[model samples]
Target: MSILYVDHEINNLNSFKATFRRDAEIYLAESTEEGLKILGENKIDVIFADHQMPDMTGLEFLTLASNQYPSSIRVLLTGNAYTDEFKRAAGKGYFHSYVNKPWDEQQLRKLMISNLR
Candidate 1:
């Protein structure tokens, strides 16, 4: 399965690519527009986005992506503590999961594997 990861910080994208490169086909996007383009061109199974992007909030990006690619699982990664609104949005189906920044690689891998099945 393929996965798409979006982050304005190129370093973050590179790090994720390095970490998961062997596990799956990884596509990295530096902007929301690029992320959308990648999604349009690819058969992505999951999307992981940073919540504090410069151009758009993770929720906004996830919401748009979810609408266009309804079956692709979405995840939001944020350093900030979870808020009530985030909980509400997630409850409403904006994203499948919310992960803290400095994520546990093993857990994420397990989640991805489970979703792929």
Candidate 2:
């Protein structure tokens, strides 16, 4: 499975690679435009984006991804707490799940495995 992860932090990209290097083909993008460029060239199975990116909000990215890459599973990872309003807002897009930052590694692994299956 191919996964695309977008984040402004280089450490996060490196950490993701270190954590899931063997599980999937991972591609890292620092900006949404770059992510889309990679998407145009590869068959991405899933996409995870940081909500607070400098280029665009994760919600906006997912909204665009909904139209451009509808089949890719979209996941938003943020440090903010969940609110019904936020969930309702994201409902219009293709986001499959939301995870808070300081993410639980085990839970993330399980979520990815189940979704990829």
Return the top candidate by lDDT.
Answer: 1
TM-score of each predicted structure versus truth = 0.95, 0.92
Predicted structure with the largest TM-score when compared to the true one: 1
Backbone clashes in model 2, listed as residue pairs: none
Cα lDDT of model 2 by residue, 51-83, tens digit = 888878877888788789988888888898876
Q: What CA root-mean-square deviation does each model show from the true structure?
A: 0.9, 1.4
For model 1, how does the per-residue alpha-carbon lDDT over 1-117 read when each residue is reduced to its tens digit? 899999998878888999999988999999888999999999999999999988889889999988899899999999999999899889888899988988888879988988778
Q: Which stretches of candidate 1 lie over 4 Å from their true place?
A: none
TM-score of 1: 0.95
lDDT of each: 0.91, 0.86
Question: Cα deviation in Å at residue 28, candidate 1?
Answer: 0.1
